[model samples]
Target: MCSGIEHGSCRVSDDGRLVWAHVVLGPEEDWQECRVVLDARDGRELARLPLDGAASGSHHMSHPDGLHMGLCVGMGQDGILLHWARRDGEELTGRDLDESSDRILMDVHPGHPGFLTVEHHGADLTLHALDGTVLAEGVPEPSDEEDPPRWDHSCGFVDADTVIASTVESDEDPDRPLHWMLDARTLRVRDAVVYPTGRVRGHVRPLGDGTWLTYDDGSGTLDRWTVATASA
Candidate 1:
């Protein structure tokens, strides 16, 4: 069910039949290997894939047509990796991200021709097409002088063109919050908001219609925000 590895990623199949988890093994002294575990209906291990080298990040994404699944992998300093499989656990393929960048992967958008958003040094955000083409890139402005923010984690897409990204001060101040509404196509800041409290460490996803949900580790709270129908 759970590998209990810190800083790993997990995802359930779109059909709700299988659960896939990629856990990092070995200590920092050794080159960590990513262990991909597939669970059956009863939460039993069906198959295991030991992927050599470090896994920068991993998550589940619905393939085109929503009929299959994709296991996205981020090999730090190497490149992006993708493992695709059918719902029945048959027919699988693995591929690299196509783009080359030292920037940290923020999240992958699961839609037609899936794309990825990565945060480069200096809080610059870069958007890449599924084929590894550079779509757009931009540097985000810090929230305030006292609380200069850094783009740390993000949710892929809130809609066809918008992504909700969580920014935080480098000094690790919980009372200062920096959130941004970025254009997925342009990688530009469309709007921004400050939470006034709490620290966010993950992507913000849409709850249903217009509301988004994100985690605040400082106060152990899940903060929800309603998307403004119109930009200010």
Candidate 2:
């Protein structure tokens, strides 16, 4: 259904069943806005939700429960909007979440009640409940040195209770990026993650099975990582 028309990014739900994207509803001269949800398994058109006066966003996400969706609108502006919608009796009802900062929803928790978000400029991170309630917020502590690491937008939950995040200053070398482990609920620094030799780079992408994934630029291969347990 997204043929020969203006369409935004398409996001798939955590279950891999639902896919959605915002599209222009009419001709260029008098186009409106709407979101089209599709069934991923069979490529069938599922629902079309009208978006009156709603601006499209760069980042979109389908809720884990498969009943709702979220959009991060107006990025790079002085203020950003977090819009969410859910099907209500054949109609999609939505609202912009009331947030005090301009942040972007980077990742949603797997098998949990909260989602992860980072500041628009990647300065801080916050965890929020499914209903937009703030659960925890913080950034890693700066080290006692001339140049401390800055948190980037590459962050997500490593599991149900732990989050994996990275820090690489804009002017710094990407090969020397640092990563951290944080308590998902409290946003507290749990530890600084250190990888084995030659596998020390790449942003973190949680696989939701206690292991995470990373890509190596030099080798051009994806790597899976998990905490090594000590012998008894």
Candidate 3:
């Protein structure tokens, strides 16, 4: 019986057995928050932990194992606070990843022990371990097409060896939207993914099963794409 909260934001666990929601404490203006872990089967409260000193968070993403998670307090270039979380049955604990306050909670790599974030205003994308270890980091080369292509705020792992990264479209070059396939380990530009329908997506979700899903907003449909090999 959860009640009396101004708002609640939830995300289903990767295993599909539980749900995690950030239950905001009243008068969100005061900057208090709680993370509630609930059972998916019956919506039972498995655990709840209070977050101190966090005014608000943009979104929450669960680790593929369903035992850990990361959340960004603010979104975009305004993002400053990112938190790492873990739980054991009815017990949950969380803390800030680093004191630096420079992280954007982009997406968690499916089946990997780390998550992804854009650093220095998308100048580089980095992979981080749950405890905040920089696993890998890379920046795209200056686009030969655009004078200087900027990394879009959206990106995610296509597989263990590849990452589907994006470049935002500009009013001057709206038709130049691109999905770059970056070598996961080196973060080097490998190739461009020719979206079957030529639609640009804001996000790409890596399904643990060697495939990923892309949504076409124009047609309101979802298309699953296979992770491409460097040769293919």
Highest lDDT: which candidate? 2
lDDT (tens digit, per residue) of candidate 2 on 1-232: 3323323667887677777777667766676666777779987777777654444345697667777788776533336667787766555677666755777877775477888888776767888877788888977667555766677768887778888888865225544436778887898887777666532666778776777887767678777788762000
Against the true structure, candidate 2 has what lDDT? 0.70
Model 1: which ten-residue window has the lowest total lDDT?
1-10
TM-score of 1: 0.60
**Which candidate gets the maximum TM-score versus the true structure?**
2
Taking the candidates one at a time, how many backbone clashes does each contain? Answer: 1, 0, 0
Cα lDDT of model 1 by residue, 109-198, tens digit: 454244555554436767665545677876666555664556665545665666666564633554544567777678788776544343
Query: How do the residues 83-199 of candidate 3 rate in per-residue lDDT, one tens digit apiece?
Result: 777787568988787757476877766556667888646678887777888888867656567456667777777766677777754323656546677777667778766655554
Q: Judged by TM-score relative to the true structure, which candidate is superior, 2 or 3?
A: 2
Our tally of clashes for model 2 stands at 0
- Cα TM-score per model: 0.60, 0.78, 0.73
> Candidate 2's error at 107, in angstroms?
1.6
Q: Which residue segments of model 3 deviate by more than 4 Å? A: 1-8, 14-17, 26-31, 39-46, 53-57, 75-78, 99-101, 144-147, 169-177, 195-208, 212-223, 227-232
RMSD of each candidate?
6.2, 4.3, 4.5
